[model samples]
Target: MSEIISDLNTIDKESIRIAKKYKQKNKNAAGSKEGTFTKIAFISISLIFVVLMLVVPLISVVINSLKLGLAFYIESITTEYVISAIRITLLATVIAVIVNTFFGIVASWAITRFNFKGKQILTTLIDIPFSVSPVIAGLSYIMTFGRMGWATPILDTINEALGTDIQIAFAVPGVVLATIFVTFPFVSRELIPVLNAVGTDEEQAAALMGAGGLTIFRRITFPHIKWALLYGIILCTARALGEFGAVNALSKTRGGTFTLPLEIDALYLSGSADSITASFAVSSILVIISVIVLILRNIVEYKVKK
Candidate 1:
């Protein structure tokens, strides 16, 4: 009887142990499944947001542009005003890139390679355009160069002295200057951190070896920041192409002075279906240009990493 009782107790204890172990395993499996589901749900939400915001708008634009067929697009793009707009945009982009690139390099070098008073102030001023409204920028330019501007008389006197009808307001030079003001920070902003990260070690060593200023820059610094500089130029080009506010304020909106953005607006406001289609066509061109810039930027970044 005693042996049987002991055997029964042992069986009961073993069964309890097995049951507890099974419960623990089931709980762990349930927890793991819940975590996996949560992860999937988060990813799904993110993908949906991207599709709605970015992909949908882009697809809509492309489809609208193509609704009238390829020939129509070509026709609209080649219109006289459209051609002039493209020319103006391209010219401004080129000038902005050149001016900003030169100054960006010099300013970035000065900030990174040397220490001086008012350095912080200089940096703050350089970044002002990013914070300031483009409309305000346009107004400031107008206030300086417009008919009632303080400098208008001075400019007029100079023009008379030079025997030229040089006009800054409502002209190509004004457009170029506005573009430059907005894009002033691109290259310098891109290069500053790179210059800081690269530090002055290699530069100092080269200097110790009696490398001249230009030589050191040519061989050492330029190679380090060339890709970043290119990236900045690409950004500046994109911004210049799409700049509307400042250009609108200063431009006369004539065939000779209008930019692509202004031309698009004019087409849209004509209240004719055909003109609207033409506007879409022109807008499609800008979109294509933006895509091209993005591709080039990626290529440059890849090269930089290599």
Candidate 2:
């Protein structure tokens, strides 16, 4: 009897343990199902949002651009004013990219490799373009370089000395200046984090081995930041290409200083159906360029990751 009782007790304990384990497994399965449902719901919402906001608008632009015909689209984009705007846009973008790239590299090097007074101030100054409005920037430039402005005397003296018709406000130079101001911080901002993450160990080692500054940078620093620099250049190019507000404030002459964005605005504001259609056609060009830039950016990002 005692042996039987002991065996019965052992069987009951085993049954209870298995029941608890089975119940716990069922609870886990239910939790997992709920979690999966939540994930799928979030992903679905994101896809819907992207399709509505981005894909639809892009598709609309393409369709409207071709709504008339390919010849109309071609004619619109090839007109003298449109061609001039394209040229100016490309010129501004090229200059901005070059200037910002050089400045970004130097700024990143100085900020990362050394310690000095006003370091924080310099960093903040670089970011001013981001915090301030582009319209405000353009107005400020006008006030500084306009005829009645304080810098007027200096500009007049320089033009007299150079014996050339050089102008800043309400000219091509002013447009380029505005583009540069807006896009200047992009490259530097992209580089700062990369340089910080890379640290200064290898640069210091190269210097200790008797490498001069340029040699150290070329051999040691350049390799680490090349991808980052390329990424920054692409970003700066894209931003400069589409800059409108600042350029608009400074550009007074259509077909002379107008960029692509400004040209599009001019077409739209003409208050004619044909002009509106032409505006969309020109906008498609920008859309295509932007898509190309987006693709390039993704490629650079992939390269950096690899």
TM-score for each predicted model, relative to the true structure:
0.88, 0.94
User: Per-residue lDDT of 43-70 in model 2, one digit per residue for the tens?
Assistant: 9999999999999999898998888899
| Model 1 per-residue lDDT tens digits across residues 1-306 | 999999999999999999999999999999999999999999999999999998888777778777788998789889999999999999999999999999999999999999999999999999998988877777788899998899999999999999988888888888888888888898899999989999999999999999999999999999999899888899888998899888888888668889899999999899787778888889989988988998999999887677
**Predicted structure 2: lDDT:** 0.93
RMSD of each: 4.8, 2.1
Cα shift from native, residue 80, model 2 (Å): 0.2
**lDDT, candidates in the order shown:** 0.90, 0.93
- Candidate closest to the true structure, highest lDDT: 2
**Candidate 2 — worst ten consecutive residues by lDDT sum?**
146-155
Q: Where's the lowest-lDDT run of ten residues in candidate 1?
A: 58-67
